[model samples]
Target: MTDVSRKGSLSFLNPFKTRSGSRSSSRASSVVDFKIGDDARKSSISTATIKETNSSGRTSRAGSAKNSLEYTRSSRQGSTLATTGEDGWDRDAQTGERKDHTDLLHSLVDESTAESLADKAQAMFIGIPAKPAADLFSRFPEGVWRRIVEFLGPADKASLAFSCKPFRTLLGTRSWTDLNSPQNRDAKFDFLGRLDEQLPNHLLCFQCGIYHVRTQKGQEVLRPTNVSNPIFNCPNVFNLENKVARHRITVGRALPFPFVQLILRGQKYSPEHGIPIDSMSRRYKDRDGEWTHQTRYVVVNGHLLMRVISSAFATPALPPAGLRRLLYSPSDNFNPYFSVCAHWRDGNLMPAVKCALSHIPKPPEGSGIAGTSAKVQYHFHRPHPIITLCSECRPMRRCPECPTEYLIEMRVQEDRSDPDPRKLFKHAVVVTRWSDLGDGSSPKSLEWAACNGEAEYDSFTALGKRAISGTFESQFTVDQIPGQKMVSMNPNKIKLGEKGHDWY
Candidate 1:
């Protein structure tokens, strides 16, 4: 019997305890060797022993050949493979193939898996219906709302309301009220509707007359300052009086006031020529028992007085020629008109008639011509107070308390050597009352006509001529009372000179 004893650390298990036989021995040893080899390879033993002889003492020896063979077989079957474990690969069981662990992990969590998770969570949370969006301006305080409205321009405010439902509900009502408020006076709608009409083109004053012209090109060209330019430098400036003098010669053609000529005709004098009278006797006693003589005369004082009262000469009449001319010619061959000369001073014109009458000495009271008295006053029929539209002149006019009336005197020079001799004619007619004609709303003064005696008629006629000639002058005074007057004067027909006059 071959005896084998397990020694050292294996002393506890007896190696010689099993039966020994030739056939049994060989099979049993082979089987035991196989089991030992399997245990060494599978359990990772540090040492291996061959039949207890020859103790070579190699403690770190590798496993026996049989054990190595068994390990190779197990590796091929992919049951238990010994590896360095550096690479991240694991052997497969059935095919014995190496597969990447990272690849396997990636396959488990892919795009489809992440999508499934997200869909499930979204379905769970978003199941309920959504409410409408809240109004953006609902929670704003009143102060904030006011600020917001102010920040938005007119167009922006209108557009914001129409943008969306919530904005319309909150801002539309408030914006409308704010836009229509009186504080927004410069707003397009407010200015166009209320202010534009009442103050169109502003106010203007030209040559003592006030007017309102329309605005051109959306702007007022002539400013209030421009209207007052003439009056600004000197309120008493009468330079334009000369322009009026030049205008008189062109009466009915260039003169602005046409009615003045008509008024003058009624006052023209027609006196008999070559009537010799003594220069010393101021009174002229006619053939009749009634005596006609000089009376009070009118005069103007001021720088403009001379210019305001001047006479305009009339053109000669055309000579008769055709058969129609005979029909047009008057049966009375004598002309009843005469020309007079006048001068302007201040803003007034003194008629030559007044000057001629003034040259005659005033008779004593109770004399045959003593009852005659001459007076002149302007009648303002429009009734409204005159407001000075010209800024240069402060508002001034005749009023009951400070009545603007004057007593004036005129002087006439008689020079025989002078080429154009002075002449007089009888008054054709008298006008007691004249209509106040013009647009009443403006600051225009009333027009006057003659009333009563031949002297009065001639006075008015000369006055008309002066006005049309642009030689009419006016002065301010406080002597006369503020009331209407009616007076009369004597009538006489006389021839002025050889010069023929045309009726205009």
Candidate 2:
């Protein structure tokens, strides 16, 4: 029976207590009770109710947090939902204040996604105490758990077993045992990668498939590919057959994988694990060529984005032989001197560069873009300082196979070393490559594998309409290129590399 008190006073619902002040049936009912001055206070849970709008256009109250709301004269008029405020939160019915203490996961992730389940799973770990969680885990049969884990991968199985002592006991040591197998090296590497937060003194080596002591640690510096620069001493370092993970930047420059790992590890965890991503940025001139390259990196959604701007001073109206001499490297299988992906030779990349070189404006009243008449060479009356490239080379080019995008352009910059004053400023062909290098998870990752030409990936399909160049460029400057068109580097979907003659 419900015993009601005056307004703003306490009420009680005691099913065991009779209205005649006598003992009744011994059935339990929720809430409080007090009998006269006997101090007969009892404790109970207080639950709030929230209205959930379901797919059927019906509003049903569900038990929730601490604050309670009672709907009065409410009807499902339009959509059984109220409009959220500008701040993306529901407001108080009368106060107009935002209800920020709501289910925030809805805003961050869709309920149907795996990320939402991960959040829920994390809550399961944090919600219960160790003893209680252990007790709860004891309720499930070990065989059932084994059956459930049968669908899990090696890394996932190890993760589950490693989460808690109860899980370890329940799952046994088979997952850990399996990780030690030679066939499960990838799985073990992936499992070890998860422990990155706890292991700052060591770095994962892809070739060796183990964590090595960081000998250089924070003092690590990127060096030339041929140089003996080791972040950590590995037995595989001296093995000629086992090369570490690295990407070729220019003809002579290469970016080691450990630096990428460091940059991403710092970004993913803390500075103690690695170094700041900005430390990876570099600007260097090739010793053998006139090409100068500047590389900058950005982290977007856990993926490493790289931008390399390679520029070379070009003479106007070059011959075909001079063009090949300027662009191609004989030592590197006729590859471009500028930064390019493994799929560079298959497309119109070389032809487009040749096209851009042809657009280098020749001085009207001079011998060339870099030279002038002997009399006019001393001062003034030079070519216009703007190098306007045609539509062929102006737009950005995205590789169809990998997540690399290229933009080729011509710019007029002052040639400080020029002897003549009139021809001091010359045209330079600038090739800017923006690439998505995947997460620093592993070498077998899609973007990384595709970048090295070891795996197949459709850049357009994976990246959609968004441009990596646009993302990389937006970080440094506000002066973004407007109406920038992006076309595939390989439009015909050709796969021939050195076998193709069009690369000439």
Against the true structure, whose lDDT is highest? 2
Task: Kindly report which residue pairs in candidate 2 clash with one another.
Answer: none
lDDT of 1: 0.28
Q: What is the C-alpha RMSD of each candidate to the true structure, in Å?
A: 49.1, 17.8
Give the worst 10-residue stretch by lDDT in candidate 2: 44-53
The residue-by-residue lDDT of candidate 2 on 1-504, one tens digit each, is 234445215323533332222122111111221211233433211121011112222222332111122122243332345553266766665557766655666755664554666787887889655565577677888788778888999999999999888878877899899998999998999899998889999999988777899998888888887689989989998787988888888897888788889989888888989988878889898787788889889999899998899999999788988998899888776778999999998889888899988976564444565455543654466456676777887877899999998888888888898899977878899898988988989988999889999998999998999888777776776356434699989899987876898788
Q: What would the per-residue lDDT of candidate 1 be over residues 289-385, giving only the tens digit for each residue?
A: 1212221111222111111112111111222332123112132232111111211111211121222232333322332433333211112222222
lDDT of 1 at 87: 53
lDDT of 1 at 309: 18
Task: Give the top-scoring candidate (TM-score).
Answer: 2
User: lDDT scores for all predictions?
Assistant: 0.28, 0.77
Q: Give the TM-score of candidate 2.
A: 0.72
Tell me each candidate's TM-score: 0.16, 0.72
lDDT of 2: 0.77
Per candidate, the number of residue pairs that clash is: 44, 0
